[model samples]
Target: MGRWEPNARMRLVRAAIDLCAEQGYEATTVAQVVERAGLTKATFFRHFPDKREVLFAGQEEHAALLTAGIGAAPEGVAPLDAVAAGLDALAASFSPEQHEFSARLTAAVAASPELQERDALKTVGLAAAMTAALADRGVPDPTSRLAAELGVLAVKQGFAAWADGDRDDAGALAGEMRTALESLRRAAATLG
Candidate 1:
C-alpha cells in the first residue's frame, strides 16, 4: 500500500497552527511543524519559510479579494463604504468552521508580541492593496488610503468580536465598528 499524503501547504499550515495552539508561538519549531504534518523538512521549507508565515497563507487571498472588491465597487459608493462592503464580502466568504479556525489563529497571533507586528504589517499591506484598487476605480484623494486603513482596522476588530469562541458570528460584529465610526464622525463634526 502507498503512504497517504496530505496536501503540502495545508499540512504545513495546519501543523503550524496546531503547534502554536498547543505550545505557544515562540516555542513552536519548524521541525515540530514538519513532524506534525507528517512531512519531511524539505516539504515544510518548500511551503513556508517559517511557522509564522504559515499562519498567514490566507493573507494573500484576502488581499486579492480586497483589491478586487474595491475595483468592482459600484459608482457612487464612497471609498470607506466600498472598503466596508469589501470586508463584508470577505466575511461572507468564510464558513463557520473556517471562521473558528481563523479565530484560533488570530488569538494565537494576538497573544504574541512578534506575531502582533506581523498582523499589523499584514493590515498595512491590505490597506495599500485596497488604496491601489480604489485609485484604479477613480478615488483620487489621500483620504482613500486613510479610509482603507481605517476600514480594515474596524473590520478586523469587528471580526474579532464575531469570532469570539463564546459565540461566533463575526459578520454580526459589524455593528460595533459602525457605531464606533459614527461616534468618531460626530466628534469630528463637533470639533469643526
Candidate 2:
C-alpha cells in the first residue's frame, strides 16, 4: 500500500466497501477510507469526489462501455440485440475479483438508504446512456426507452444472481444477464 501503488482507484473502492460494510455507509468517512486504503486524502479525491462516489466510481466507465458496445453493433441490428451487445461489453469488464466486491456492495447498499438512492440513480444513469445510444442508432422513442429499461433490468437481475450464486461460477454474469434479457423478451412477446 504505497502512496503511488497501481490500481489506486480499485484500492479506494475496496477500502470504501469494506469500511462501509464493517461500519455503515453513513458512519464511514473519507478519512477512514483513505486511511484504510493506505492512501492520502489527495489520492482519494483524485479517484472519487467523495466517500459516496467511491461506491460508484465505475459509473461513467460502465456507461461508456455500454454506449460503445451499442454503437459498435452492426447496422440495422434490432434495438434489443444492440442492447445485448452493450450488456456483453459491460459484463466483460467485470473480473473474478469483483465477485466478492459486488456482493459486499449489494449488502452495503441494502443497509443504507443513501447508498440505495445512489444505486437507483446509477441504474437510471445507465438506462439513460443505453437509451441515448439506441436513439442515436435511429431507434424510435418508446422502443428505445423500452429496450434501455430491459437492459437495465437484465443487468440488475443478472448481477444479483451472479453475486448470490457460487463465486467460482462468477464468470457466468454475462450469460445470466443475457438470459434475463432473453427471458424479458419472451415475456414481452407473450403480451402480444
Candidate 3:
C-alpha cells in the first residue's frame, strides 16, 4: 500500500492487530506496527497518540454515531427500544469482513492488562455517552442509567457474537443483539 491510500488509519489498525495477534500486545511495538503497515512511525503517530490509542481511535466517532442514533429514534419510543435503535445503527459500521479483525483485536486486548483497562474505560465512556443521550430523550434518572447500561451490554454481547459467532453479516449480528436485548428485558420483567 502507498501513502496515498485512503485507509491509512485502517491500515495502521490492521497492522497493529495483526502484529499484536502474532506476538501478543505487550510484546508488540509501534515500530513493528508501522513496518507491518508499510508506513512511517510519523504516520502512525499522526493517526494515534500511541499504540494503545490505535485500538480506540474510533471512540469519539462511535459515541457520536450512538448519540445520533438515539436522537433519531421516534418520539415516545420505549427507552430500551431507543437503545436498540442506537445499537443497530452502531453495528452498521462494522462490515462482514471486519469480523475476523475484531476477533483478533479482542484476543490482543485480552492478552494485555493495559489494553483491557483501556477497553474498560472506553466502554464506560460509551455508556456515559449513551446515558446522556437517553436523558436528553427524557428517559428518567435510574431508568436512564439502567437503560444505558443495558444498551452497552447489548452492544458488547452483540460484538462478541458478531466477532466470534457463526454469523457473518452485520444484519444478523444486529438481530442477535436485539434478541439479547429482548432477553434482558424479559429477565428484568421477572424482577419485582
Candidate 4:
C-alpha cells in the first residue's frame, strides 16, 4: 500500500484536479493541494516548479515520439496530414485508463487563468517543435508553422471534447484534429 501513493507528481496533480473540480482552479491553493496529497512543499517543488507546471508533466517523450512519427511519414503525405498522423501516433502512446485523470487535469488547466496562459505558451512551444520536426523532413517555413498549429489545435479540441465526455473516443482525437485542419482549409478558401 505504501508503494502506491500516486507516484508523487501524479498525487499532486490529482489533488489539484480534485480541488479545482470541487471549488475553482483559481480558488485552489498549493497548500490545499499539498495537504490533500499528504505531501510537503519540498516534495511538490521536486515534482514541479509551480502549480501550473504540474499539469504539463511528461511531455518530453511525447515530443520525441511526435518528431519520429513525422520523420517517418511517407514523402507524398502533405504537411498537415503528416502532423495529424504524428499526433494520432502520440495519442496511441497513452492508454485509455490514463484518460480520466488527464481529463480532470485538463479541466483544471482550462479553469485557471494562470494555467490557461501557461497552456498557450506550451502550445506555442509545441508548434515550434513541430515546425522544426517537419523542416527536417523538407517542409518549409510559414506553411510548416501554420500546419503544426492547426494540427495541434485540432488534437486539443478533440481531446478536450472526448475528455469532457463519457465516451471511449479519446483515440478519435487525432482524426478529430484532422477534421479541424480540413475546416481551416475550407475557411481559408472562403476568405480567398
Candidate 5:
C-alpha cells in the first residue's frame, strides 16, 4: 500500500469514527484509533485529550463562533433578533462540504450514551457562551438566557435538517438555520 500521509489529526479523527462505526464506541480504544490512522499513540494525544474529544473537537470553535456572532450584533437589537443574527453568523461558518462529516460525527455521537452526555454538555456550554456574549452587550437576564437558548435550538434544528440530507431543501446550512430560527419565532408567537 502507499505510504500513509501525515495529516495526523484528520487521520486520527477518521480512524476513530471508522472504528466506532465498525465495532462500537464503547468497544473502540485509542490504540485502535491510532493503529487505524497509521499513526502513533502520541499523535492522538497531541490532537485530542481523549477518545471522546475526537468527536467533540469542533465544539471549541463552535463556541467561539457563537460568541463572536452574538458580540457583533448591532447595538440595541432586540434579544431574540440578536440571537437570530448570531445563529445566522455561526451557520455561515459551515459549508456544504462539511455536511457529510457532520452527519457521520453525529451518528457516532448518537451511538454512545457517554458521547450523548458530552454533546449535551457542549450544547449547554454553547448556550452559556452565547449568553455571556449577549450579556456583555447589556442584554438583560432572562432575555439573554432565553435568546441564547433559542439560538441553540435553532442550531440544533438546522443542523439536524442539514445533516439529514436536506441540502436540496434548505440550499445551505445558513439558510437552514435561518429557517429554523424563523420557525421558532412563529411557534413562540402562537403561544402568546
Candidate 6:
C-alpha cells in the first residue's frame, strides 16, 4: 500500500458501505473492508476504530457543527430557531455525492439490530450536543431538552425525505430540514 493516499477515509467508508449492502453488516469484517478499499490495516485503523464506526464517522464533526451553529445564532432568538440554525450548519456539510451513501447507510442500519442501536445512540449523542449548546445560550432546562429533541427529529425526518426524494429536486437537504423543523414548530404551536 502507498504511504499517502488521498481520500482514504472516504474510500474506506464507501467500501464498507458497499460491503455491508452486499453481504450483511454482521457478516462483514474489518479485514474485508480494508481489502475492498485496497488500503492496509494500519490505514483502516487510522480512519476508523472498527467496521461499525465507518458508518458513524461523522458523529463528532456533526455534533460540533450543531454546537457551533447554535452558538453562532443571534442572541435571544427562540430555541427552535437556534436549532434550525444548527440544522442549517449540519446540512451544509453534506454534498450531492453523499446522497447515495446516506441512503445506503440508512438501509444498512435498518437491516441490522446492532446498527439500529448504534444509530439510536448517535441520536442521543446529537441531542445531548444540541441541549448543551442551548443551555450555554441560557435556554431554560426543559426548553433546551425539548428544542434538542425537535432538532433531532427534524434531522431524521428531513434526511429521510431528502434521501428518498427525487435526486433532481431543486431543494437541498437544508430546505428539507427547514421544512421539517417548521412542520414540527407548527405542530407544537397547535398544542397550546
The candidate that achieves the highest TM-score relative to the unseen native structure: 3
lDDT of 4 at 65: 66
Ranking by TM-score: 3, 2, 6, 5, 4, 1
TM-score of each: 0.81, 0.95, 0.95, 0.83, 0.88, 0.94
Instruction: Tell me which residue pairs clash in candidate 1.
Output: 162-170
Residue-by-residue lDDT tens digits, candidate 3, 116-150: 99989999988999999999999989998898888
State the lDDT of candidate 6 residue by residue for 95-167, as single tens digits. 7767877788889999999999999999999999999999999999999999999999999999999988766
Ranking by lDDT: 2, 6, 3, 5, 4, 1
Least accurate 10 contiguous residues by lDDT in model 5: 1-10
Model 3 accuracy (lDDT, Cα):
0.87
Global lDDT of each model?
Answer: 0.73, 0.91, 0.87, 0.75, 0.81, 0.91
RMSD (CA, Å), each prediction: 3.2, 1.4, 1.2, 2.5, 2.6, 1.8
Quote the RMSD, in angstroms, for model 2.
1.4
Candidate 5 lDDT, 1-192, residue by residue in tens:
112566677778777877887888899999998888888887789889999999777788888888887778789888777777777777776765467567777788888899999989999999999899999999889888888888899899888888886573324777778888889888878987
lDDT of 1 by residue, 68-129 (tens): 76666788887777776666656655555556576678868978998999988998988888
The per-residue C-alpha lDDT of model 3 at residue 30 equals 96
Cα RMSD, model 5 = 2.6
On a 0 to 100 scale, what is the lDDT of residue 180 in model 3? 81
Ten-residue segment with the worst summed lDDT in candidate 6? 165-174
List candidate 6 stretches off by more than 4 Å: 1-3, 168-171
Query: Between which residue pairs do clashes occur in model 6?
Result: none
Winner on TM-score between 1 and 6 is 6
